[model samples]
Target: MATFEATAEAAAKNLESGRTLRELSDLFTPMAIRVAITLRIAQKIDAGRLTAEALAADTATDADVLERVLLHLVTIGVLTRNDRGEFGLTRIGEDMLVENGKAANPPWLDLNTVAGRAELAFTRLLDVARTGEVAYSAQYGTSFWDDLTRDPSSGTDFDVVMAGGMERRIREIAEAYDWGALGSVVDVGGGNGTLLTGLLHAHPRLRGTVLDRHAEPALRTFEDVGLGERATATTGSFLDPLPPGAGGYILSRIQSDWNDADVRTILSHCLEAARPHGKVIVVDEFATEEGVRCDSEDDLRMLVYYGGKERTMEQVRALAADVGLSVESLRKAADWTVMELAPAEN
Candidate 1:
């Protein structure tokens, strides 16, 4: 009787914790929404497919199951069902539609895309926890980059998603530094040339090179943006030797995807490329103090996706020290933490 009373009190406390019981236990809604997005239900409804049968036909889904899912969407205010059994989108549902060639949500949420397929590895989080292995490889036979490379379109899609999402941050990084003074810079592992293009656009006198495994995307972006004359793309890897004697080497948001040893190697290459007083500018979002809810969640996502974990500022400093580099300046440019490194004085 006493144990029963204790369990009852614990349950009561849980109810009083302000998170709705449904919110805590309900996984169906999110999965259903993702299905709706993958099936383009919102797009179809906007295009006048108002009945479950029609939507099922359009999406090649089971009519009965799709009808039930539609009803749940209505109950959850994502859709509305009328007396005639026709369905329509509510304001919430309308937001799911693409507008002006931009998705209402990030492209990573669409199950049809590479990022979407990658995030499905989150379902294997338990396996990851037990074995300390990456959830991505367990879900798919290959690592994230390998999967992307196997599908050429997947690589381009992933790059577009990343470049599109970081548009604002790219602009901030461009404005935060004086690229003109550097005269020439190399963006190490710079995918799609998005960051380098922004810098060149912001500083007319600046010339830049992009060193990446694939050169076509970066070269195409440079041409599309009319900066081809000033910018060049070289096919290479940051893990190997980088183009030498650049005024500065920019490593933006790349370190978080690697382990400490690999990160040290990458930084060492950049330092070598930036020798004789050139700077190695590191821009990344470092982890903050633990117990911050958002950072914890993001760290988990990184771990599951790439076997990478966000580093704290002190951890970053220690890695830099290992590579014979010292932090010359650290500041925030918009939402990014920008750290400039120079070789330690002998």
Candidate 2:
């Protein structure tokens, strides 16, 4: 009995130590995954280059180092290794394919890309926490928006990720809201018109407009989505006057990039453009009483990139009230909240 008790305690301590080590080394998996994605290893594996030697030769990487990465991936269930010493894509590994058709190379998985660069900017979180400034700015010496604007390639990459990543969320938002009565809706700060196109496609009767300072890409999106006739792209800042008196106005995932003052200004623009009876839809990450459902890492990313924050429903209500808009309904769509607002009845 004494020996058994001692053995049990020893096992528990070993387990605890393993857990602690895993927690500390959590960064290793993502970095390894990123390297794999960068080398298109999943694609190569899918194409039948399963051995580390073949993959390393094709990718021009060291065979031994690549084998270590493959071994790590196998341990993490991303890849499967057979007794014959062959590696192949596991279920999760398939998602890392560079050409998975709409599900392709998720931006977060490609750490060498712009979106990944944005995520990696979190390394300077200490600077952001110290100065109440964005870590991206601290690291890159430019705001996230400015960085994107200055570099067209990075901007396009960012837009692609945003569009692809938010496609499901956009569908959820469209289905959650009632657009039967609305004739025209404006998507404020709509990037590449992805959300607008989704909403327009979901509601056939709803004609839409994409409002952004750079409307060229959005115009192209409208044309590509077969929404050229039903949608219009207009160039303007949400901080300025919107195309006035639309039946609906949408601000999706835009508020989390600004402080209260700027958010209020944007809300006021939505209010001014929305017809008295029109719906002003604010779709964003809301901190709930149940705790933040949105990615906490993403919340930190917002702080590091734009000095913005995810707001609670109560905070959103107050902002709406300040702008003479009342929250008529609040609905959860995926990880975001879709708050429908209308002019307050005084």
Candidate 3:
């Protein structure tokens, strides 16, 4: 008994020291995803029978290395390996690999993609937390937003991958809203207008305006989503200004990207654009320190990729009130919270 207890204590210490099993899992998740995408393993098995050898040939990867990765992924439940040595997609894997319909998701989760490659810098999250700044600024000497603006394509992955990945979540939020009575909706910083496009298509009576810094491709996306007639694309920065006279303003996935100071600026813009009785809908991380947490992997991604932080309901309420907005109520969903607030009273 004494020897067993001593061994247990030592194992626990090792588990918590350096990189624990948990930390290693966190570290390799994005990389393993990237490896899968790079090798097109999912694509190979889409129609069902593909030997491990075929995957290496099709993707031009080392057969031995590819086989090891797939085997490891299977061990972790990412992919399934059968007795015949054939590998195939799991339900979650299928959702991520499907090219169309509800199965379509963010390729950003795939590390081999261009955006995923750059996002791997999440290892530098230590620098971000230490200085309250982005490591990108340290290594690249520019802000994440600035880089996207300077190079238009960097933001495209987010528009397609992240937005598409979150489409199901957005659908939940859109359906939850009191759409029975509403006029105009403004999607602030709505990348490629996926949410707006989804919302407008669902609530046809509602006219939508997609406000973004890079409004060019978003305009094209309107036509692509077939909401071109009901929706319009416009240039407006929530951090700077918003379109005048909106019935409700939605800052989905926006506020958490900024610190409190910037959130105030954006909220103030919402207030200015809001009509009397207009509600400001803030869709973001609700700063919960408890159950059903934000994606820890994605949390670290923001800290490393763009130097953003997730916030809680309390943090959001304080920031909104400071910007002359009052919280009316809180609405909860599976992974996000919607703070229904209005311009401050008196």
TM-score versus the correct structure, for each prediction: 0.86, 0.74, 0.69
| lDDT string, candidate 1, 1-346, tens digits | 1245555976787889766878766878877887888888998998999999999999999999999988989988999999989999898888888631255666566777667787789888888889987888888888887776667676787677668777788788877777789989998878899989989988999999988878889999998988868999998889897878888899887887777878999999988878878899888877654523226566777788888777877788889899999998887778677788888872
Ranked by TM-score, top first: 1, 2, 3
How many clashes does the backbone of model 2 have? Answer: 0
Per-candidate clashes come to 0, 0, 6
Badly placed stretches (over 4 Å) of model 2 are 1-18, 21-25, 45-95, 98-101, 150-182, 201-205, 275-279, 290-295, 331-337, 343-346
Instruction: Give me the overall lDDT of model 1.
Output: 0.82
- Say which prediction, candidate 1 or candidate 2, comes out ahead on lDDT: 1
Model 3, range 145-216, lDDT digits (tens) per residue? 776676666567656665756768877777777642568878888888888877776677888888887888
**What is candidate 2's lDDT per residue for 1-346, written digit by digit as tens?**
1245555975787797776666554887888888899788998988899899999999999999999988999988999999888998888888888542246665656655556677777777777778777777777777777766766666666777677767789889889888746788898989889988888889989998888767788898888867768998887888888888789899988888887888899999898878567789988867654444334556666787788887778887888899899988899898788898998972
What's the residue-level lDDT of 327 in candidate 2? 86
Candidate 1: list runs displaced more than 4 Å: 1-22, 99-101, 165-168, 289-294
